[model samples]
Target chain A: MSLDPQIAEKLLSEMRRGAIVLAVLGQLQREHYGYSLRKNLVDRGLHVEEGTLYPLIRRLEKQGLLTSEWREEDKRRKRFYRLSTDGREIYAQLMHDWQLLNTSIQKTTGRSE
Target chain B: MEIVDSYLIEIGQHLPEDSRQDILAELKVTLEEEIGDRAAQAGVEPDVQHAQAVLQRFGHPLKVASEYRPVRYLIGPDLYPAFLHTLRVLLTIAAVGVVVVSLVAAFAEGWQVGVWSLIDVGVSLLFWILVVTTGVFVAIEYSGERLGWYESWQPRRLASGSLGIIDRGDVMTNLVTEGVFLLWWNNVLVLPNVINGDSGSFVFNLGQVWAAYFWPFNVLVGACFVLHLYVLMKGVWQRPSLVLEIACNTALVAVLIVLVTSPEIVVVANETAGDQSEFLTNLVDRTLRISLLVISGFCVWDMWSAWRHFKGASWRRSSAA
Candidate 1:
């Protein structure tokens, strides 16, 4: 069976929310500010929008899942965000969820072979 | 330097007052740092134009403005779908309410309940449905589903750099225009400024007692609106503590009823002119009066909700400890 390109794209976009959060958590194990974080994620081929990234950063901070502080770097203060203690716990759980999801997907797709 | 400074100011103008200077400082530092790097790469001396270009590459005023803003959803993400569902339910209920009331009124009048009655019922139903649906859509679209809608939705979040710095100049102008129309059509300006005291006016009006003449009243009204705008921008009003919200809303309804119904009974004779019926005019007058009262009531509710949000944040912090 074949899917229309637009439909497939929309479906992929809709399912990417969880993937984005997981990616953010994994990357934020090391502190990175907004632009650098975006660049790192994109460098890894994960495309996140600036509009999406800033808000997500704030939300993660507010939820106590991420800790952030502004520090002077090369004459400019940049807000560096990293995983909080709670965020570490959350990251671990999310990693478990991801592995389960990944295995389930692999099993279903593998069965087709 | 001039161009970079102006651009930074423009960006700062869109940020919350508390964080405006800090953000501007950061932006300046960022521009300087980035432009220095770019100039080094190009082997050209760093200049104003070069910094401007780099800032331009970063994004425009609106784009940069948005980065510092809380996530806004029309119906807000967390409870918007639920709000939409509830709105549908409310509209259905309001439609049924209008029909039943109109029917009862028609039958009580001992009329045969003719075509005009049917038309009246239809118009009432259509009017409320249109109103409720438009309101729900606006609330949802402006405040609804978004990833960070809830993060800055609290009342104190009104002071947050992201949601707070929004320049509502365009909206304020529009509101002033609407307010002028409301004042003119209602003959509200003609009413005396005296609060619950008699003035040498031709007629005593109940609306005059609770009129929006006083500055404090205006301030309270303005605060309610600001709170509403804060909620709309932050997108938390949709999924706020369900019980607390419902109770606040119910209290508003009760206040509105009292404000409206009181004028009808208390200041009956003063509600009319020679040919004009006091009861009818008073009913219309009181409705508007009650709406203002309810608005102020909601402001008080916003205060409560703000306290709750602060408590929740504090609780979270303490529990983590």
Candidate 2:
């Protein structure tokens, strides 16, 4: 069946919100600055845009799910970010809930996981 | 790099002040890094085009800045319906008002002059009304004093008579009316050379008596313009304004008396007329006189009704006190 592109994209975007947050948190576990983080996400087959990444990280930081500090890297100062202690615990629970939800959906839809 | 500089400057304007520099600094790094990556992928050195491409991907300055800030509406949803209704009524009236004024202009001057009048009245009316409406709404939104508006319920108000409060729509109408009249009197619009009719048209000029009241008319219109402007800004009529309104009406009555009583209101110059000059002049003069008489009646009636309304408003206030 054919679907309208705008509706399809909008559906995908709504679905991506939690996934994007998870990706950012999971990726930030490995200490990357804004550009490197965005690059890594794009490289990982996730379609994160340039405008979407920084604000998400800042919001995550405000929510106590991320920590950042400015330090030198490759002879340039960059704000490197990683999951905070609370962030690590929260991410673990979120991952657990995410996996459970995923398994439930797959079972309910009769899709092979 | 200039493109990047301009982009950052634009973004900085819209960013929240407390975190502006930090946001700009981080954005700058990401932008420059993105450009370098694109350049590397394309096997070229980073340049202005690379910066331009990166900034373009990041989107408009306001869009980018908005992402970092909490969303806000200038006129929030609570007030939106009222705002929309106000705009609808005002703009509809304005559209009709400008066409009517332009028709009057076309009758007095030429059709080309009427077109100019249309454009002049349209721009001034629509632009100022929108600005004033938006400004007023924005002020209300920011003040937050209107929190009561959300809680207040008055079903009776929907069916009640006039509350004597000034209607913003009426104020806007008066403001635009006075403004357009001022523009017409000042000869702000250029007049094109009108082609005379097949039989040729008469050049009708008012007699010296009318010419003598030129500045007086100008000053009179100017004062009315200023008074209405003041009333619009204040959003209510105080005793002083009511007095000023009566004074302006009194002066307008005197001017109308002089204009209508004049023996030679519109005389056709024979040099500019065809063979049927006398007949055309008489026809034109009578029309002019009739128009003046109609206008005088309208003005006097308007003044009378307004004074009566204000007098009622005064009694209401004093009795309430």
Evaluated with TM-score, which candidate comes out highest?
2
lDDT (Cα, tens digit) per residue for candidate 1, span A2-110 = 8689998889888998899989989999998876787789899998865566557767887999998889786567888899999999999999989888888989889
Residue lDDT tens for model 2, B55-158: 88899988888899876899998888878767766775665555455546655774434446567767898899999998998998888747365468677645
Query: What DockQ does every candidate get?
Result: 0.17, 0.54
Report the backbone clash tally of model 2: 0
Provide the fnat value for model 1, as a fraction from 0 to 1. Answer: 0.23
Candidate 2 chain B has its poorest 10 consecutive residues by lDDT at: B186-195
Once fitted onto the true fold, the runs of candidate 1 whose alpha carbons sit more than 4 angstroms away are A1-17, A42-47, A111-113, B1-32, B46-60, B72-121, B129-321
Top-DockQ candidate index: 2
